[model samples]
Target: MKLRHAMVCSSNQNRSMEAHSLLKRQGFDVSSYGTGAHVKLPGPSLREPNVYEFGTPYKHMYDDLRRKDPELYKRNGILPMLKRNSSVKTAPQRWQENAADGCFDVVFTFEEKVFDMVIEDLNNREHKLMKSVLIINLDVKDNHEEAAIGAKLALDLCQELEAVDCWEDAIDDIVAAFEKQHKRKLLYSISFY
Candidate 1:
């Protein structure tokens, strides 16, 4: 059976989206979310904050940014990124705010902060189904280049896991292999970039 997965990051724009897209391309059932209070990004000016709520339509935000400061949006590549991100099934959501769906078999977080938030949400929730979900924290920075690198690492791990028939029985070994690969990838990325 294909394992259901979820990816989490500070903002749904970069890291989470990258992993989500990669996983989906590989034929896995996956979803991505943000753990922040609101979607935040660099605006036209230093003082301007591009803040968007969870339910904000991606197109709305995109159009607003385009109209507000077309040059800045294009210059930062946010326009194209937003266009790609808008195609995702769901909008940005907070881990704590969403109701427990018990759909995901594994959850991957791009940073420690999002990892903690996922754990805290799982702990505080009344649903026991969450206990069965395996949470993996991959220390990836939230940037265009880093997001792409992290997605490649995540895809490698997922492909490894996909080969195993019994996921629960093989989780420990899978995690160990993932960590080893992640470390190697991180080192190689440092040298490469």
Candidate 2:
């Protein structure tokens, strides 16, 4: 089976960026972009809390997988010619063509800006491939915050779809929540697709 497509969008690479990385590690075909696409310069606004630098570790994790996983891009010869220009590239004004091309199963927006922009754009477009898109904001707090945010985001994602009987993953978080809230693990079936 093909892996599901997931996209994450956030303003200034922070919590949302972190979630994007973790999702990719969990084996989803994921991509992340920032909401600062129109910014002409990298400045104070980005350094401020909640702002993440474009192309920084905040948005893409595991330390430059392009270099490490050369095999994945061998056919395109992309691994060897890593460009330093990406350090300052503008985030996309909208979700990229690939996502719109019907390759994605879901898209998650981390901040209000991204959700407002991307969701409204998608909702207005007439694309048969745009099946399900979710816009959600994570409630942020203190230190150890990354792990807290990551875990909760993952669990919550599994829960939301499970509530509607729409996911097939065997997440203990979702299963247990159903048992606790609905009082039955045996309530539903027909596999999540």
The top-ranked prediction according to TM-score is: 1
Off by over 4 Å in 1: 184-193
Report, for every candidate in turn, its global Cα lDDT versus the true structure.
Answer: 0.71, 0.45
Q: Could you estimate the TM-score for every candidate? A: 0.84, 0.49
33-152: candidate 2 lDDT, tens digit per residue:
655543222222446322223333311422344444545533332222122213323233235432455444445554455656666666666765434444444333322355346435
TM-score of 1: 0.84
Task: Assess candidate 2 and give its TM-score to the true structure.
Answer: 0.49
lDDT, model 2, position 17: 42
Pairs that clash in candidate 1:
none
How does candidate 2 score on lDDT? 0.45
* Candidate 1 lDDT, 84-148, residue by residue in tens: 78887556766666635545666777777677777777766676443366677777876788988
Clashes of each: 0, 5
